[model samples]
Target chain A: MKFFSLLFFIIGIQFASMAQTPESPAIVFGPVFGDSKLQELTYYKINDIDSVQFTALKFYISGVELIHQYKTVWKEANSYHLVDAFQEQSLSLPLNVPTKLKYDRIKFNIGIDSTTSVSGAMGGDLDPTKGMYWAWQSGYINFKVEGKSNLCKTRNTEFQYHLGGYRFPYNNLQSIFMDMPASQLHVVLDLKKLITEMPLTQKHHIMSPGNEAMLMMERVINCLSIKK
Target chain B: MKYRIIIVILVCILLSAFHMATEQLFVAPENWPETTYDFSKNPLTLQKVELGRKLFYDPILSKNNSISCASCHSQYSAFTHVDHDLSHGIEDRIGTRNSPTLMNLAWHKSFMWDGAINHLDVQALGPISHPDEMGEKIENVVLKLQQSKKYPALFYKAFKDSLITGEHLLKSISQFMLTLVCSNTKYDSVMRKQTQFTTQERNGYMLFQKNCGSCHTEPLFTNLEFENNGLAVDPTLNDSGRMKVTGNKKDSLKFKVPTLRNIEFSYPYMHDGRFKRLSDVLKHYTSSVLQSPTLSAHLQTPVVLSSNEKVDLTAFLLTLSDKSFLFNPKYSFSK
Candidate 1:
């Protein structure tokens, strides 16, 4: 009788543990420059007029959520991730969503929200030491893309674009929604589309958050699409 | 069974003791509004505040190790840059605006003269990276702090981890700044009914309530809102204040209304430190207010104060200067 009771207790504990554990889906994001995957110091052409070499590309992807039938299904808690092209480990985001929930769409913000920006210093990916936070402006630089290009005017032939603003009218945080058929997904950030769509000569060297930053944010958002 | 029950009770007691210890770190003044800062994110502890105090006084925050936060914000002048109109930073580089006093910051919603920084924890970044200021990056600052002999142990004591992080650095600075509460002034004593103001001060108090009370407010001595105090734009600097942040025309010429708690020592008033004395500030309010499209509505009507009233008002303002806060050894350099 004692052995049978011990067996029942062990089974009950296992069932309870199984009930508590939920499946968390992982989503991987791959940044590519046109047909080629993004690599530092790789030269790329823009509209045959501009030849650019990118040295750094980093951005923030936050507020990850899953939507179904025009309603929200799952949202990741503390969903801020800093994606650095140099850091391969940062490309994958493990989302805490139940595998049973079927979602048709995925949505996220391209930058840190105003609430987080005002909430003070945070740890993990949101730490200011990540080189993404603007020390002078007291807000995160949502997107940082730096490179060298002979395509024209600045000294050292270097072009830098740091796009971010949390205030109204010039807020640079962009909401991105992509159709997803499976819980496990991959998103592509096409730099080719961004460089080709925007005029580099007039818009390069953007460091502060404003109208130019907003335009750059829109251009970056336009280039993001789900990978097949 | 007895041992299990005792273990559970001990855990409960430990958790409650931790709760009580955190509560003791932050002491909101009697009748003051609750602090705007969310303490749960960076809970206050004695060790963290001590670490913050050390960092505030250390010049290592600068690139060249010559300037610290205390360089511009000295305790003698209520943590403001005195004598100089514009703040002097690294290598004698002059800033665009006067360094504001650092007190009652836990109630502040935004920081800096133009409210450029929305949070207090991130405010250090403004000075640390500004070319004229500390001229250091947060990453480099972290690396330096990590390599320091004293900081690693301090970090371990405050955060229980020796690996220094930018979050820990910023939060510790905030912990010290949040403790800078200047509420024990004569004005506070009178308000609490523990003492009485002189007849001249009483008259000045009434005049202040009638004229400056709307923006300066009582008790805290600041409503903590941005306003255009009607100083004509400086042709040399042309600082556009809040308009530059919001990109809105209406916010032009608007600057954060500074607290008047320590108006005595924090001389050279206004955003640019254009006024060297309280009388000059009062004179501007009475006679020198330039009418502009974006001027504050409250200042549109002249603040009429007679010569005697000005002196009396200055006397009342003097009551706000707390000697205890200025000389508090705890807030001083921790050696």
Candidate 2:
């Protein structure tokens, strides 16, 4: 009987180890995609835009520090994940930390990591197979922006913004922080503000990180000032 | 008097709980150090372990329902791809790097050839939606798994819910992988004095410490740091290792220090699966280190290994092959 109990105890312990999950929090920091009018097509030329297509649009957001009552509770160590709203079906940012304690403010950066990009075949946010990560060319998509527009010529253009540079002054990982009450743990990004002032022509198909991806990502993230 | 009585009751309860927990938690192997992974956050359970095993064998974890983790990482091959230079994914798409063997992964602070993935639980998402790999989204994969006949019950058993979130999927896989402890190698036997290395293997062991021991350290067989072991860049692939992530040009040509355990079988070797044999790897190390700013200091001087020494080194690497693990029914595919 004692031997049987010992066997049962060993089995019980083994079962317990299997249930432990790492505390990586996944939060939806996505578009306020409700009742927004869809726009048209056009070429946004390289030097400001003649016409271009935007098939997908997304970029990195990192350096997120969560605060409660102006005191930081938790902040991501190295949080720069590509949040592509255009191509990806849903935007769920899973944070890697123990979230047993509640958080009020969730601050993060908006760009890809130089380390994450070079690392081969990452599993989560940095999965290279996503095409979000360039194949041996650069590294992480740093930022990915795509959408089709109607400026002229082609009806739709496939614009892919793959921004990332490990070579000297080309680093574009952006830091972004947010303040919010625990109850109002909502992050809303408006697409219209990111692309343009209003009537978006097919001139804003920006992909990859450069002046366009950098400027556009800055605008998109900045436009995301807390809805106080 | 009442306070003292309450304190005594609390002490008794706490003592009993602590005793049970100590028996429950793994007492580390004698003389072996602490594990990097903190198990207190998520306690192990039999139901969860069984659920994890089921998930490990299931293809529902992948995007296409065609390729699973087991597709690239086979148990027979030390949880590494057997023959491929580069790992092939769904639709026969080729990836940039070779799959590393998965054993004693709990000691690994980071994963992948460049040490990109810090945690183990969320590592599966890399393969699931990679365009050259699964090419499907996690949301869609979750939907598929949620709708599947096998997963709901498995998820419930693992997490007490069948909601089938990505978090649950990743965690289950981590659970299965963490259980893969490879401490029964011949090297381990020699350490325990159960068996001694043959003269050739013993010679090879000494040579290994002299040549490869710094990066492929003893006990766990890795220092867990990235290094440039001096492989000339493939003109076609042109991978710059850790430099791509840091954006610092200094880390160019650096790759994660791969474990030499089971090094006999888990080849075609290196990140891109360039070298087919251990001799070729040694030859490259001894003679062909490309001059780079990021070259590891250990490989600065040429390793003077005679042809006989190469044979001895190969013999030592072979001792790491734990046949029992390769054929372990506990880790193999099951329903």
Candidate 3:
């Protein structure tokens, strides 16, 4: 009788532990060229005339928050992630949320904040060795996209955009808010819309912080959308 | 009884450890202003300082391992490359401006002549990645440091992590730089009533107070403000100084007023190292101040000084040199 009671207690504990386990959800960022997925060093036909191949696409996503109704439900601590198109693991960011916390909206910044920009050195994704930092002027690069297009008349037909500026009149940090869909959060950044909208010939190279970077950042913000 | 003894031993060890940990790493000179460097973020440790000292002297930071911070910033010349008007870098590529002296940096709010770098931690990144300088990226520098046989162990000892990161790398370098205190000059001794200045020096001091004290200031020897001290722009360089950073015409030709401390050794003077002698610098203030739309307000009025007064001022300026800081074995390369 004692053994049977002990066995019942053990089974009860197992059942309780199973009920308490929470499944962690992730926010996945997908880079796509129109309908097809974007691949590094792979050429894609743009506007049927120009052939564009992306060599690199990386940007900083920081200050992540989940909003319920109008109020913030959860905020990631030290929330900064470098989403690189080349690295598969970096594309999906795991979020540790409460078991039953319900959030309707997801908000994040497309670049490092002004505060972090002047706060000296940092570790992890914000490290200066991440290639997203400008060495001479002292600021994060914010967003970097490099590619070769047939339309570009410059060296090797290349176009590089390193958009960043923390100071006023050219602060390129853009906040993105997406409505949470029924399924898991998946944000798609369509380069097709970006490449089509931006003039590839005249504005082929933008490597510093200025009016051009700010305008390019605005165009980058428009490229992000929640895929239904 | 044995357990009690063991507990007591453990407590003693822990107490001693706490005592050593609480020992101050950097102590400011008496009556000096609070340092602008935020030390709480990256507190100095002896191990880290030593690590940074090695990194400062290590040419591994350069692309071809030919140049280091010490290559431009030597210890003897107030941490600046003297005799070179324009400091050359890897492959003998000359930079646009002179390498500024690195001392009393803990009080400085910004780095570079134009104040382009906002923080000291990220200042090295500018030279490390400049095409004509070290010609290496911070990422590559980190990779090289990690692969180095000696650095990994040293980094682990200093940072307590074998894997080297840029944050730790920069912070360690900052630790070594912050330790470079330039106090203890003859001027400081006279101020402390330890000694008296010569009659000539005293007269020069009074004149300096009347003429140059506003911008050069005292103690740190710099007001840390930007000024265009009437230098005619070099058409070859076309360097616009602070105006390039701010994009404001009002800041045209303005450069950070460098510390007057160790002026005897940190020559040639000015942003471009144009003046080779203290007399030339004095001449510029008195007779050759090129009037500009954005010249410093202090320099708007002409400075009148006789030859005797210039000699006396030069004598007073020589008192700012601190030989102890120059010859300090602590700052010198260990290996």
Candidate 4:
């Protein structure tokens, strides 16, 4: 009788432990629009500006908040990550969450944090492995814009727009909110429009962060399309 | 001349929707802390990582495909080239600093002894394009990977497409590197309470905590911060460490703190590989640290140790050796 009771106690504990652990959520991010003809995220129509096929899209969601409807509700600030096309790999944000680890609402910064640029190698979206990191220059390509235009002085212009500055005069990370329920959310990126519509000059290859990096990065995700 | 044009062409072709590639999983070790990498944005799969590993070990990354990352970053010696102080890349070329050991990379916030490269996924591009290293163009590397027979299938499996572009190739290498975790040493066992430290090791551990543990932290054996441990600059190398990247006058001679875990095997210590033995390293810490504007406050005062203290610190460092990781078959040649 004593042995059976011990086994039952162990089994009971295992069940409780399993119930406490939360399932990892799926994270998917990519270009939401493939071409200009495919509608954009904002109210604006897709068109070429000044004869440049400028695709107006948004990715810089300055903030992403994680809200947990389960357990006791909580929240975190600046959770949305920077998305770069030329130098960075597609992002995969981890979602394995507990109600406390996540909140019913998730708040995140859209551009690179001022602290991260100077602090050194950051993991994930900040890791140099993503290729957007600049070793010689001490900042991230917060906003990466690369495309060709026949109308510019150069036959085809490849513009590299890296916008970021942690110090005064160049902080580009922005904030945006989502009506995503207190539950899990999915953020998609349609990269197709990014390359198709943009005023690019071959002379401008943005490898580092600056006003150009910030302004261009903001424009890319300014009106990012999302679904709950 | 041709290289510049190809970069332009790739920039244009990449804009096409059909050219976009998928990302794959770059999973972290179980029970380990959450990884800094965001794999969902660039999902993890088998193809890209294996290609990266193959590319890492292959000679093709160099100008002549003569010296691969494995040339300097061997699996043995904790992936650091042990023969020379400064790294050698292509055509017997000499780099300015020692090639740092490569392991537990997923957790590391920076790369190179000076914390030069910030991310692991993009770190390879440095060597591939470094003048004295691989000396190849990123666009050319893409062309080479695209031409490989085994890589096309590998790319498709990882990214769901047959194309092997630079982004896909670079991402694949990042995947393999992310899997290179090294945390199974005897020291880790002690932390987990699975075993006890030997008398010598115990004494050594105490000495380390007192002396070197602050900079060479535990769990990872490195704080992953840049510090001027105070070695005078080598005129020939003229390396500026973090200052070169940040342009801050206060950040001179500050190299990234290296992990002391595999110090026993990875000889020729420091960013410049100036010391050959632990004794020299000890002596430098005790007496040779050159006072500079950016010198770490910890080493501001001399580190005085007795002869016995030196031996104990060395012994404690040995416990960081994880044989399984150093000789793991998975990390070795694919064959």
Candidate 5:
């Protein structure tokens, strides 16, 4: 009877542990215009006349963390995700967090950090082959948004903003903190809000890292919000 | 007990394999400063260094595969293009500045005439992406290397992964460059009391210490600081050097101080290669130093060298050349 009870207890403990440990929680990014989901290279109606089409929309999301009651409960190891609007897979970021973990907020940086920027070439999403690193100088392009608009005066009516800088007096890295309600972890990046805030025609191209990049980077993070 | 014995033997085998993989490939010359490169991140190995050497000579890094790093930086000329005032690149394109000599680069804090590149690993990106130079993107280069028959195997042998990454590629190049130590010069011999300098050479050394030692410091032969050496600005090129990088007027006309080692073969000199001969460089220091607000503090007090003193200085400068370094078979192209 004692041996049988012990076996039953062990099996019960295994089942209990299995119940406690569920699947890994995931974070999904939803890039949308005013009312609809964003489609790459497709013209979106902004107003009565001007329509903008995004050829490329990409940004780096790094230093991911899960916060509970204002304390960090869990953090991703070497977390760096290059979120691309063109790629379907890149939007759904997989977090290696236990489903049992509790968190009220999700915190992350919108760009590459200063330390990683100076630390030579890296592989995976941080690789120079990803077309995100500057060739003439040493630094990563934190956020790249290239598109054409009928409103612009330049050739091809194109506007390109490649925002990144890790150095002082011009660091473009921005931190974001969003509340996680009901464990959904879905973040919405509204492109309409970003475009509406800035004067597109005048501030069309911002290629290098500077004060302009800092301003554009602010606009980038300002467009992100929790999809509750 | 048998299982335990087998485990012990397996552990021994594993330990030996690890030791062989990380065996020291670079030994720093005694008493030199600690290298700036973080070798822990990319440890040196025999396979990686050999792979880097092959890559250094290969023209596959260029756009049309017509130009290689060796085209502009020949080993015989101490790894710099000789007689070319400006760097000649692919399609006979002329670069804005002179191609700096490559020697004892392990000590360099930054690359390029203007100190634009912050680290050595990212230095190749400048030339590779420059329209006049290689005119190739790093993405295309990685793709080409992956598709190549020999590179994938070579990369696997070096990094233990057949998949070629930019990190592995750059780290391997750094391993080869770290081995280009030039400490076998005549001046080095004299310093070690292996030989004595001629009386004229000794006098020239004293003059050098007084006049030029501050900017071009000892041992490494460069302080590794950017300074405006007072070269008259070329009206046509109108290059502002370090100022363009920092966007500060205080840094205007400041260029990285070139190492005096291997100066005999590595010329024409200066950022623009304006001075063809060592004598012309000396003349510029003595009489032709263009005075500007950003001129190096050391050159503020004018250098006055007599004609005979110039000859002694030239003789002393030649002693800085290391035949062993210039002709090292290890640095040569291999199949």
Candidate 6:
């Protein structure tokens, strides 16, 4: 009888511990071309004129923060996520905030910061093996979008943009903020907006971070929005 | 019971011996600025430094397995390419800029001629992936290291894991490079008040202070800032130096100010290795400074050095050479 009672007590403690831990809310990001969901190799019209198709698209989102009112209530430490359009699981980020806490806004950086760029090699999303690192220049490519477009006059009608620069005068890292509700949050990236804004004829191929890269990076910021 | 206790003590001793053999502490020179390298990320270890030395001397980093880092950065020449104006790498492919000497890197905020590399740990990627240099992808290098009979075991000992990662590869190389500290020159001895310079050398030291002290600084012998030294752009290379990285017109032709330490063996000088001798370098400073929009303000005023003063300055520059650093067997190949 005594042994059975002891076993019951231990099991009760385990159940109580399990009940105390809460499930984290999921923050999902959906990529789309205006109203339509994005698919690889799908033809899309930009400004209803230029026919464009994307083969690859990958970018980094870092320094996620939860803002209540005007002040920052919570900020994720060492927050870096690589979002690949083809990878379904990469787009969603599960945050571990308390269920009772309320947040009015979400903030994040569109690219890796200067500290991580110079912090040598890293693993996970910041790993050099992720095809995001520029082996020739010793910096990570913040955003990479590769595809073919009829509007692009280059060979094979391809357009590639590998954007990265941590130094001053051409630093391409951008910050974003959006209003949030007390429920599951969804962030959307509209490809049509980016494609329409970019002047494909005058300049299309942007591999290095410069003034052109900064301009394109600005368009990337404008394309992101909170979806209801 | 007594035997078991004895065995346990013996095991403890063995474990401590192994720990001592593997771990090492990085000690900075007294009165020097704190190292820019964040040691918390990649801690120093004797085993990792040894592994880095082996990798530095190995040609497996190159695509063809023909050229090693030692090919360009030989110890005798103060870890710089000696004769070639520009660095020669795999297949005798000529590079655009001269290979700079590698020493006192822990204090450096950036690397390369144009400061393209922001960290010493990531600097190896530049040469390894350059078309005219090693021309090997980092992934392939890791794969090769994983397959190598000797490297896997070495990596296991250093990193406590058999798997070779790009992070470990870079951090290990950084550990070896960090050990390269050249502070025991004759000038250092004078600064410490252990020795006195000869009359000629002393005179040269005065002249150096009056003319070049602002840029060259002291101890490390570099201000660690980029400057436009007024060298005419090479027609073939057309290198814009720091301007290429920043895309700012103000940064045009502004190459990093190199350390004067070991400058004797580190010639030919300049970004493109345009000056072959110390005399040529002095001549450019005194007589051949080309006026440009981006030229350093320090060089705007003419450096009028008499022939005798030039000789004195040269003698003082020679005092900066640390023979101990050049011939230190610790930095040489393990075998």
**TM-score for chain B considered on its own, for each of the candidates:** 0.93, 0.90, 0.94, 0.89, 0.93, 0.93
* Candidate 5 chain B, run of 10 with poorest lDDT: B20-29
Q: Specify the poorest-scoring 10-residue window by lDDT in model 2 chain A.
A: A33-42
- Chain A TM-scores, per candidate, are 0.85, 0.61, 0.89, 0.58, 0.88, 0.86
**Number of backbone collisions per candidate, in order?**
0, 74, 0, 78, 0, 0
lDDT of 6 by residue, B56-147 (tens): 99999999999888889998888999899999888889999999999899899889888888888888888888889999888888999999
Fnat: each model in turn? 0.88, 0.00, 0.88, 0.06, 0.81, 0.65
Off by over 4 Å in 3: A1-23, A181-183, B1-25
Instruction: Score residue B177 of candidate 6 by CA lDDT.
Output: 89
Which scores better on DockQ, 2 or 4? 2
Candidates sorted by DockQ, best first: 3, 1, 5, 6, 2, 4
What would the per-residue lDDT of candidate 5 be over residues B68-148, giving only the tens digit for each residue? 888888888888999699997789999999999887777787889998787788888889899999999988888899999
TM-score of chain B of 1: 0.93
Query: What's the DockQ for every one of the candidates?
Result: 0.67, 0.06, 0.77, 0.05, 0.64, 0.56
Question: Over 4 Å off in model 6, which ranges?
Answer: A1-24, A34-36, A41-50, A136-138, A181-183, B1-26
Colliding residue pairs in candidate 3: none
Q: Which candidate is the best by DockQ?
A: 3
Candidate 1 chain A has its poorest 10 consecutive residues by lDDT at A17-26
Question: Which scores higher on lDDT, 3 or 4?
Answer: 3
Docking class of 6: medium
Model 2 regions lying over 4 Å from their true place: A1-146, A151-155, A160-193, A196-215, A221-228, B1-29
Question: What is the lDDT of every predicted structure here?
Answer: 0.88, 0.69, 0.90, 0.66, 0.87, 0.87
How far is each candidate from the true structure, as Cα RMSD in Å?
A: 5.5, 13.1, 3.9, 18.1, 5.0, 4.7
Clashes of 4: 78
State how far residue B141 of model 6 sits from its true place (Å): 2.4
* Residue-by-residue lDDT tens digits, candidate 3, B1-335: 99999999999999989767645456688899989999999988899999999999999999999999999999999999897888878999999889999997889888899998889899999999998889998999999999999999999999999999999999999999998998889999999999999999999999999999999999898999999999888999999998887767898999999999999999989889999999999998999899989989998889999999999999999999999899989899979
Error of 4 at A26 (Å): 34
Pick the TM-score winner.
Answer: 3
